[model samples]
Target: MQINCTVIIQAFNFLITYLFLRKFFFHPTVQLIKQKDTAKKILAEKLKLKELAVSNLVAKKNSDLDAFRYSISQRYQKPEQAVIQIEPNVLSKQEVIVSPEVIEECKNSILKGVHNAL
Candidate 1:
């Protein structure tokens, strides 16, 4: 069988044009669209992750606050040590705090047993 020159030339032209478009136009266009789609998907996922993180942080903070409130509400949590701790220069409603001279005299009377043993 003999091939026609016109048909063969037309077939060659079609192949070259298709290859050129695929290499220089269609492939890059498709790749660009794919890249854009991937970027959009990534951005959406990032936004979702950020929202979840914020919600988790808020939930954790609320839980901590609730725990703290519950702890404080449970009892007369004022420590015994605080009641015993002494501050300088304090005066009662009827009594005044004298200087160290009077304080030492009062201590001797209060601890009379220790003084006798010594």
Candidate 2:
């Protein structure tokens, strides 16, 4: 039950410090964190949109290339190579892509088989 001058002064000092920190330090720090979160979200959305655009462009390019190949194959029809036209359907259905080296090896093996048959 001792009410002194020092206790009152100390209580007032504590209140002022709390108010100053809340206004200058805590509020600004919280606002900065919110701003950074919003910036990251905006960047992520932009990246996703760009990725979608790139994927669409790639799909269009692939379709155009396929159309060009089909047109060329049709224009250059060889009567002597009727097997090639028939084989393309089977190869397209398989969707198998082999390297040029593998194709060369396969050609060599076919030629050897033809020679052995002869």
In terms of lDDT, which candidate is strongest?
Answer: 2
Q: What lDDT score is found at residue 38 in candidate 2?
A: 100
lDDT of 1 by residue, 25-77 (tens): 99999999999999999999999999999999999999999998888878646
RMSD of each: 10.9, 17.4
Question: In candidate 1, what residue range of length 10 has the lowest lDDT sum?
Answer: 78-87
TM-score of 1: 0.51
Give the clash total for candidate 1: 0
Name the lDDT of candidate 2: 0.86
Q: What's model 1's overall lDDT?
A: 0.83
Each prediction's whole-model lDDT (CA): 0.83, 0.86
Off by over 4 Å in 1: 68-118
- How much is 65 displaced in model 1, in angstroms? 3.9
The candidate scoring highest on TM-score is: 2
